[model samples]
Target: MTAKAKYQEVLDLGASLNIQNGDVKEENGTLKVWGTANTPYEKNLIWDKIKAIGGESPSDIMADIKVADNSVYHRHTVKSGETLGKIAIQYYGKASKYQDIFKANSDILKNPDVIHPDQELIIPNA
Candidate 1:
């Protein structure tokens, strides 16, 4: 497969993430991709996708993904029936780290257990 076709899923992921200034080009046998992500989490997601498809350090692709926000790991919108533990697990891979998430969102969250849908919570860099 052509380099571009081989990484089509990565391009699609970038589009779905609403990457800014996205550009894609295939030169020789390498795919070059550039874009700006809203947060480190999003940027990592792109790299993870690329690595998943191309291996850990594939020479077939070169991506210069930038992060627009470095203050927080991610800004997550709460969904119904989602708890801090769940969000923590999704981001930190440990449910017990919910306290950190609660503390980071203390301004908006009066209680750790109380969160409503649509509330934007900061997933602090942990």
Candidate 2:
């Protein structure tokens, strides 16, 4: 599979897990999850298993908040000859929005200018 396709596959697997419930309450322009699962140990175990398989946490798992849906969030892998700007334009329709792509994927991208093959990146909608 292509690096981009592989990255998306990993994201699809992560979205399959019962991780986050999209019940965020908006207050003063801030969206917050209303409730949390009581059994943290059970939740942690689930999270650990997901992590062991190269999946990333959707949000702060420890926080008393529901999980958010990230299915529409595109995951891109850096291939040779790919640039952050190119990715931004390809996904968001604007090269200047590369910063948005970079910010959404800070976990995987240490430097915007430098990305390697197989490194997954989140592509946020504009």
Candidate 3:
């Protein structure tokens, strides 16, 4: 397959993740991808998709995935049944740190107790 065609899914995956500064180039039977992911988790999601398409390690693709917020451990997309304290415990190992997450996401989150599914939240650096 042409490099473009071979990595189409990876490109699409990057778009779905809202990658910033995304660039794609196909040359000499290889695809080069560059983008800044919002978080390490987002970067991993892209790599996971790449490996799933090209096996454990794919030589056909080169990806430069930079994290937008290197200080934060991860960017978490909220799910049903997830609370700020629950998320805090997952990242900070202390449910009390929910206030930190609440302050970090105050732009979209009005209350610490409320978060909806698919709402992206930044897990700030400890």
Best by lDDT: 1
Q: Rank the candidates by TM-score, best first.
A: 1, 3, 2
CA error at residue 101 for candidate 1, angstroms: 0.7
Q: What is the lDDT, from 0 to 100, of the residue 96 in candidate 3?
A: 98
Model 1: lDDT equals 0.95
Residue by residue across 59-84, what tens digits does model 3's lDDT show?
88899999997877698889999999
Off by over 4 Å in 2: 1-72
Q: How much is the lDDT of residue 57 in candidate 3? A: 78
In order of listing, the candidates' clash counts read: 0, 2, 0
Please provide, for model 2 over 68-126, each residue's C-alpha lDDT reduced to its tens digit, 9 standing for 90 to 100.
43343455668988999998877666899999988888887788898887887776745
Angstrom error at residue 73, model 3: 3.1
lDDT of 2: 0.54
Best by TM-score: 1
Please provide TM-scores, in order, for all candidate models, with all chains considered together: 0.98, 0.43, 0.65
Better of 1 and 2 by TM-score: 1
Query: On residues 77-101, what C-alpha lDDT tens digit does candidate 1 reach at each position?
Result: 9999999999999999999999999
Worst 10-residue lDDT window for candidate 1 reads: 43-52
